[model samples]
Target chain A: MAASNIDPAIFEQLQAKIDEEGRIKDELKDIIQQLEKQGRVTQSILSRIHNTPTGQLGPAVFQPCERSILTQIHLVKVLSDIASKHPFYKWNNLWTREMQNLIFCLQLRHWLAHQELETIEQVGNELGVPINVKDRDIFHLTIEEYLLALTNTIDELTRLAPNAVTLGDFSRPLQISKFIKDIHAGFQLLNLKNDTLRRRSDGIKYAVKKVEDVVYDLSLRGLLPKQRSSDDTPAEAKGGAGAPASDMDSDVFLEG
Target chain B: MQMAGMKRSRDGPKPQGRADWDSPYIPMFENFRAELDEHHDRREKIIKASRDITASSKKIIFALQRVRNLGEKIPPPLIKSKEYSQHTSTIHERFVSVAPDLKGINAYRYQRQISPGIQEFMEAVLFRHYLETQSILSPSESAKLISENVLLTEDDYVLGLFDMTGELMRYAITQMATNGELPASRTGGRGNILTGLQDLRTKLEALDVSGSYGLSKNAEQKMSTTRTSVEKVENAVYSMTVRGKERPKGWNPGMDTSRPVGEVEG
Candidate 1:
C-alpha cells in the first residue's frame, strides 16, 4: 500500500465527467422544452379536428394543423442537431415522449388530408429528417417511435369516426373505420415486447372495436353507402354508445 | 401473415381516390416487421451475451475474494488456476461476441439490454485493480477492458464504482477475521482499507447528481447501500478494539492465526 492508495485526481475526473453529462442534458432539455411548447400549440390546433366537418376540414383543420406542425418540425431539427452530437439513447428519454407526440401530429395531419396512414418515410420527409436509420449515429425516427406514433394516430381517428357522422358526413366514418382497422391490422404484424410501445399498441384493438361500432351503427340505420355491409342487430345497436359488447360485432373486427 | 383478403367495397369508395385494399398498409407494415424483427434479434443476442458476462464477472469477483492480501497479484492458486481462466475467458468471449451488435448508434440503442453486464464487469475489474494496486481504477483504464464497439457511459462507470465499495467492505471484514487485525500496511500507515473506504465515501458523498434521470436517480439507493457497507466495517473494527483485552489467548474473532503481515506503506 502506497501513502496514497487512491488518487484524488480520480474522483476529480469522475466529477468532471458527471458534470459534463449534466451539462449535455441541460442543453438538450432547453431545446426539448422548446419542442414541448411547440408541440402543445400543434396539439391544440389539431384537436379542432373533432368539431370541423369533413368538407371544411381542408381550410379549417388541415391548413392550420400543417402550419403548427411545420413550427414543431423546426424545433425537432434543433433538438436533433444537439442530440446528434451525443449517443442517441443517452438523452432519448428527455425527448422521446415529445418526439412521439410530434410524430403523432404529423401522422394525424397527413391522414386527415390524404386519408392514409403516413409512412415513416413520409414522416421523415415532411420533417426533413431520416427515417428508421440503422447504422449511423445520427438523429432519426426509430421504427418503434414510428409505430408508437401510428398507434396514437389510430387512437385519434377512433375519436373522429363517430364525430364525422355527427357532422352529417356519413361517408367519413366509413373511411376512418377502414383506415383505423388497416392500421390496427398493421400493429398485429409486429412482434412487440412488453414495454411502453407494446402497451400503447395493445390498446389498438380497443380502438379498432370502437371504430367498428360506429360503422355498425351507421349501417344499421341504412346510413351506409349500400356496399360491403356487416350487419348488426338493430335492437343491440340501440344500446351501448357503439361499444363492441356483443361477440357478434367483435367478430367483424377480428375477421376483417 | 396474409393481408385480409376481404373486399374494401364497403368503406364509401375509399375516401381519397387511392386504390382500395382491405388493409393498404400491409406493404409498409411488412417493411416495419422486418426492421423490428432485426432489432429484436439483435436485442436478444446482446441480452444473452450480457447474461453470460454478468455471471462470469460475479465468478471472477468470488475468485478474487480468496486472496488474503492487498497490493499484489492474486495468489497463483486462486487466480492462475483453471477456474479463474475459465471466468476471464468467458467474459472476454462474451464481450467480443456482443461488440458488433452494440456498435455505432446501436451501442446506446441496446444499452438497456447490455448495461447490467457492463456494470458487473466494472465492479469486478475495479475490485481487482484495487486489490492489486491498492488504488482507484481510472475511467481510461476501465475503457481498455471494454471493447471499442461498446459505449460505456459515465452513469454505468459511477454506478459500478459504487458497487465496488461493498466488495472492499467485505474484503476488509474477511481480512480482519482471518489475520486477527485490520488489513493494513505493516508500517501502520494511513493507507489501510478503512482509510481507503472513507476516502471513497467522501468522494461519493460530494457528488451532486440530483435529477430523476440516469445516475442521480439510481444513486440514491446505491448511495445508501454504500453508506451501510462503510458503517459495517467501522462497527466491526470498533467491536474488535473494545473487545481485544477480553479474548482468550491466541483466540481471534475473525482469524485463527496471524501470518506474516505484508510490509507496505512506510
Candidate 2:
C-alpha cells in the first residue's frame, strides 16, 4: 500500500524530538573530546614511566597520571548517566562506533595502572556504577572493544622493547616478550571475524618478533641470562638460540 | 565470550522488577539485541524510501523538460503543474512513511548517507522552477516546498543550487541551439544567457554562509564549478549569435541541415 502524508502536529513533534536528540549528541561529543584529551595526557605521562628505570621513578610519576585517568573515569560515568536518558543503546552502538578511540585509551590506562586486564565489573566497582543493573542500562566497554584496546596496549609495549634494551634493562625485554606472547596465545584461542580484532591479532606476531630481536641483540653482546626459564630446555630457553618462530606453543606460558 | 545484549523500554510503566532489588535471579538483557536489529531495519526502510523519492523526482524533471518549447505560455511555472505536484506529493508520502522509524534520529546525522538522493531531487526541482520563473529559490521556500517537518538546511539548499546551475547551463545551451531564444536580461535582448547566469551568481554570492561547518568549502568548490558551467553556456550562445548572421535565409537552427551551422555561408 502507498504511504500517506503525516499529520502536521505529529510531524512537528517528531522534528522537535529529533532536534533534542541532535543537541544531546553534540553535548556528548564535547564530553568525548574532554575524555580524549585527558586520555592522551595520561598516555604521555605513563610513557615517561615506561622508559624510566624502576628505582629512579618516584611515586610522582604515577600520581598525576592516576589523577588524569580518574578524571576520565568520572567523565565516562557522567556520559553514562547522560546516555541513559535517551535510547542511545539503540542509536548505532554509539559507545563503540563514535568513541572507540576514547574507550580504547581508557582501557589502556586502566590496564597499565594494574598489571591485569581491567574487567568491566572492576571498572564499575571503582567508578561506583551499579554492576547488577540490567544490561544496556549501563554503559561499559564491551569485551571486543577491550580486546582491541589490549592489542593497542601490546603495540605500545612492543615499541618500548628497544628502549628497554638500550637503557640496560635486559630483564624488561624478557618480561615484555613473555607477556606479549601470552596475549598472542590468548588471541589465537578466539574465533575473531575480519574486523579490527582479527587485524590487531595479526599484529601480535610482529610485536613478538620485535621483542625477540631486542632479546637477540642483547644476548649477542653477552647481556641475557644463560637460561632464564630454569628448565632443562637450555636451547629454547636462551635468548639467542634462534628457535623456530612458527612454534605456536612456545609462547603459551600464561593461560587466561 | 559472554557478550550481553543491551535494550531499553521506550515507553511503558516502570517494570515491577525494580522493587525486588535483592532478587538473586536478574533476567539477562535479551531484548537489547532486538533494539540493534530494529535500528538496522529502520535505516533500511529510510534508504529504500529515499531511493524511491529520487527516482520519482527524476521522472518529474523529465516531464518538466517536455514543456521546454511551449512558446511563452509554460502554464504558471512547472512546479505548479500536475506532474510536479504529483511527484512532490509522493516524495512527501515516502518521507512521512519513514517518520515513525526516524523519531529520534536526526536527519542531518544521515545527511551524508541520504543527501545525494535529496540534492539530486533538489537539482531537478530547482532547475524546473528556474526555467519557468527566472528567479532563484530562497532556502526557506525550499524547506517549505520539500515538506513541513523535513528541514532542508541552508547548506544542502545552497549545495543543491550549485548543482541546479549546472543543469541550467545545459538547458540554456539546448534552448539556444534549438529555439535561439536566450535567457532574458534586464535590458531585454534576444541573447541573454550571460545575464541570467550573472544574476544567479550575484544572488548566491550575497548569502552569508562562511560558518556552515565544513559545508563552506564544498559550497565554494561547487560555486566555482557552477561558474564554469555558466561560462560554457555563455560561450555556446556567443558562438551561435556570431555565426547566425553568416547562415542563409529561412534557416531553422533546430533543423539538422546538410552543413554545420558555422559552415553555412549567408
Candidate 3:
C-alpha cells in the first residue's frame, strides 16, 4: 500500500500517542533526576550493609538518616503517582509490595551509612524480613524480570476490574491474530536456529492467539461484531456443506 | 678389430662417390627436405592459430562489460545527419565481414538509439551492481520502501521510525554506560520504555480505522524480545546516570531528559 492510502484517522491517533509518549518520557527524565539524588543515599546504605557481617551491627544506631528517609518518601511518592496514572481499574498488591521492598532497601541503606550495623538485624526483625543478602539478591534482578512482574501485576488488576480497562475501539484482537500468523510465517521463512528468536516468535504468536480467541468468543456472544453465522445462511443449509459457501461468501465480501 | 678393418675396407672411399656426387636424385632430395620444412612451419602456424582461438574463447569473447554498458556508457550514433548513409554503409560492411557462424548477429547489428527498454535493462544491471556493492539494503532505503509502499498511516510510519530511532538511542546509551559516561538505571524502570511503546501500539490498534498498521505475530513477539534487550541497556544507562549523580560535581539530572516530544505532536 502507498503512504497516500494510509488511514488518516489511524495516523492521527498514532501521532497523538507518539506525542503523548514523548511528553511522558520528558516527565520521566525529571523524575529520574529526583530519583537519582535519592539513589545516592540508597547506594550508600546498601554499601554499608554490604560491609557488615550477616549477624553483626555497627554503632551510631540512633542518628537520623535524612537522605535514607527522603529516599523512601520519594519512592513511595513515585509508586503512588504510577498507581494513579495506571489505566488498570485496580492497582495490584504486587506494586505496593514492590514499593515496600524499596522502602526496606532505603532503610537498610540508612543503617549502613550511619554505621548503625547492630540495628540492621533489629530493623530486619521489626519488619519481619530477613537481611540475607546472599539469599535475597535484590540488586541482581534484571529489568526484563522487573517489567514482566509489573506487567503481570497490571494484567491481574485488569482481570479483576475488566470494566476499568476500556477495550480498544478497533478490531485489535483480530489484528493481533493476524500478526501472530504473519510472525509464524516469517519464522518459517527465516528458518532461524537461535533459541531466543524462536522464543520471541512463540511469545508473539501466543499473545496474538490469545487475543484472537478472546475476540472470537466475544463475537460469538454478540459482544463485538453483530453478524452471526446463521444470519448469512439459509436455515435449512445452516448445518450442512452449504454452510461453508456462506462463510466463503462473507470472507470474500469482507476482503473486497 | 678385424671386423672393424673389414668394414672400413668395404666402405673405402669410392673416388669421392662419383666426382661431384651430382646425381639427378640429389636435386629431388634437396627439394623434398625444403618441402618438409615448409610443411612443419605450416603445421606450427596452424597450431599457433588454434591456440590463439582457444585462449580468446577461454576469456570472455564478447565484450560483456561493453554489452552491460550498451546504453549508459556508449553514445548512440546520430542517424539523421549527412554522415548517416556513410555510417550505414560502414556498419553494413563490418557486419558482412564478421564471422558468419556468430549467433544473434542480426539482432546485434540492428541496434538503434537507446530506448526505454534499454534504459530499464541498464537500471536492472545497475541495481544488481548496487546490491553487490552494498551487500544489503541500507536503513534509509528500507525506510523509504516502507514509507512508500507499506499500508500504514502516518502514525504507523512515525511509530516504526521511532522504533528504529529508539533502538539506536538504546545502543548509544548502552555504549556510553559501558564507557562509564552514563549510569545504568534500576531494573524495573527500563520496562517503562517498552510499556510506553506498547501502550502507543495498543492505542493505535484501538483506533476504528480499518487495516491500520500493526505488528505481525512474529514481529510483535520479536519486538517483545528486542524490547527486553533494550530495557536491559536502559537499565545500564539508568544505573550509570544514577551512579554519576552521587558525585558532587558535574551532575545534571536534566541531561537525561528525553527529547523531540513536541515534534511528535499530531
Candidate 4:
C-alpha cells in the first residue's frame, strides 16, 4: 500500500490551535504568579490576626480575610476575562469545567507531593483501576486482589465527573483512567510490604546451628560418592567380558 | 453370458503397478491425510479471525481520522472581550461618570440615597480592603471580632465581602501587570483567586520564621510596632469615607474620588 498524503489546510489549522494553546499556557504561568502574590497578601493578614491580643477577638477572626480577598480577586479577574472572551452563558460552562479540572489537578498534586500514597491510590481506585502483571509469584495473588478492589472503586468514581459541571471531558482518555488505576495498584503494593511476614523473619539466627553441622560434615568427607563398579574387576578382564568366553579363549590361544 | 465374459476379459487382471487394496499401510495413510485436512481447517480459521480483527482496527482508525479532520474545520469560540468590547466600554464609562461624586458620599448617607446595588458595591470594596490588609481580623478569629466591632449581619455582609476580595485581586493583578509580571485573571469569578489566596495563606502559616530568627523582646517589640504601622496604611486605604455636612457627602480621604486610582492617566 502507498503512504497517505497530508493535507496542508488541516496542518495549518492544527498549527494555529497549538499556537493558541501555547499562548494560553504562557498566560497560565502569569496567573499562577498573580495567585502567589495574592497569597502573600493573605498571609500577611493572617500573621496580623495571629499576633492580635487573644482576649480582643474571637477564634474565627483569623479565618484568612486577606486570603478570601485574594480569592475573590482571582475569581473576579477570571470572570472579567471570561465575560470579555466568551458569550455570557457559554463561558460559564467552560469556566466551570476548567475550574473543576484545575482543582482536581491541584488536589492530586498535593497528595503526590506529601507522599500520601494511600490517598492517591484511593482517588485513582475511585476513578478506575489499572492492572499490571509481573513475573514474580509472591506478588501475584495480592496484586490481582487489589486490582479487583480498584475496579470496583473506579466504577463509583467514574460517576462523579459526569455530574460535575467543572469536570467535563475528564473521562475522555481511557489511557489516563487506566494509568490512574495502575497508580492505585502500585500504592497498594507499596503498602503491602508493611504487612509482609518475610520482612519480620531473621533466617540467619534460626538456621545457624544446621549450617554449622553441614559445614562440619562437608569438611570430614570431602564430597565423594561411594565405590565405583570398575573396582570389582581387573581392567583386562573387563574388556573380554562383553564377548563369548570360548571365543575369547580361542583368540587368546591363537595369539599365544 | 457372452457380455459378462467380455467384461471379465477387460477387467480380469488388476494393474500390476497399482497398490493392493488389502495392504495394511492404506488405512494408516488415509488416517494421516484426514488429520492433515483437519489441521489445515484449523489454520484457516485462525487466519480468518486475525484478518477480521485487523479489518475492524483499520475501520476504527479511519473513523478517528475523519473526526480529526472535521475538528480541524471547526473554529475556536470567539473571545468575549474581543467580540464585545463595546459592552465593557459602556460599563467603564458608567464607572467614570459616578467615581468623582462617590468620594463626597458618606457610607451611611450614600446607602440612603443611591440605589442599594451601588451602595452595596462600595461597602463590599471597603470590606474587601479590610480583609486584604488583615485590618479587621483573621478569618479564624473574625467571628469573635464581628460580634464585637462589625454590626452587619452575615447575609448582608457576604456579598460586599466577596466584592471587596474580588477588587483586591484585581488590584494585585494590576500591580503585577504594571511591574510586567502577567495579565490579570480574565474571569473575575472571585472563586479561583480566593482558592489561590487561601492556599498561599496556608503555606505562610506553616513557616517557622520565629524559630529561625530568634529575636530578643525589645527587638520583637520594635518589629511588631513597624508591622502595625504598615498595617495601618493598608487599613486607611481600605476604610470608607466618613460622612458630615461640611465634609462632602462621600469624602473618601485616600485619594481623588473623581479619578480611578489605578488607571494610567494620560
Please name the candidate that would achieve the greatest TM-score relative to the true structure.
Answer: 1
Question: Candidate 4 lDDT, tens digit per residue, A1-256?
Answer: 1111112342233334435534544554455445555544543453342234322223433344424543735553654453334222212222333232323332332322231223323433432322221221111112223323333233323332122112221111111222233333233222222222223212212222222232223222222111123123222222221233233212112221
Ten-residue stretch with the least lDDT total in model 1 chain A: A231-240
Q: What is the DockQ of each candidate?
A: 0.35, 0.04, 0.01, 0.01
**Which regions of candidate 4 fall more than 4 Å away from where they truly are?**
A1-4, A47-53, A57-75, A83-256, B1-266
TM-score of each: 0.86, 0.57, 0.22, 0.18
DockQ of predicted model 3: 0.01
Alpha carbon lDDT of each predicted model: 0.76, 0.56, 0.33, 0.30
Error of 2 at B229 (Å): 1.7
DockQ for model 2 equals: 0.04
Candidate order, lDDT descending: 1, 2, 3, 4
- Indicate the residue-level lDDT of B217 in model 4: 17
Span of 10 residues, lowest total lDDT, candidate 1 chain B: B257-266
Candidate 2 wrongly placed segments (more than 4 Å): A1-40, A52-61, A70-102, A113-151, A157-256, B1-52, B69-90, B147-149, B183-194, B206-210, B240-266
Instruction: Summarize candidate 3's per-residue lDDT along B163-183 as a digit string, tens digits.
Output: 432433343453353344432
Question: True contacts preserved, each candidate?
Answer: 0.52, 0.00, 0.01, 0.00
- Where is model 3 more than 4 Å wrong at Cα? A1-5, A49-66, A88-256, B1-266
Candidate 1 DockQ, CA atoms = 0.35
Candidate 1 lDDT, tens digit per residue, B1-266? 22222232243333322254446688888888898889889999999999999999999998888777777767778776888889999988988898988888888888988999999999999999888777788888898998777877777888999999999998888777666577765555447888788888878898877532678779989999999999988877776788655553333443423432232111
lDDT of 2 by residue, B1-266 (tens): 21111012111111213343221111111232343345446666778877878887777767666566422345556667777778878888987786554433345334554565677678776766565555555555566666544546555666777788787776666666556555453334322445666666655565544544435568778878987887786666566577655555434444433566566433
TM-score of chain A of 3: 0.32
- Candidate number that wins on TM-score, 3 or 4: 3
In candidate 1 the C-alpha lDDT for residue A185 amounts to 69
Q: Using lDDT, give the best candidate's number.
A: 1
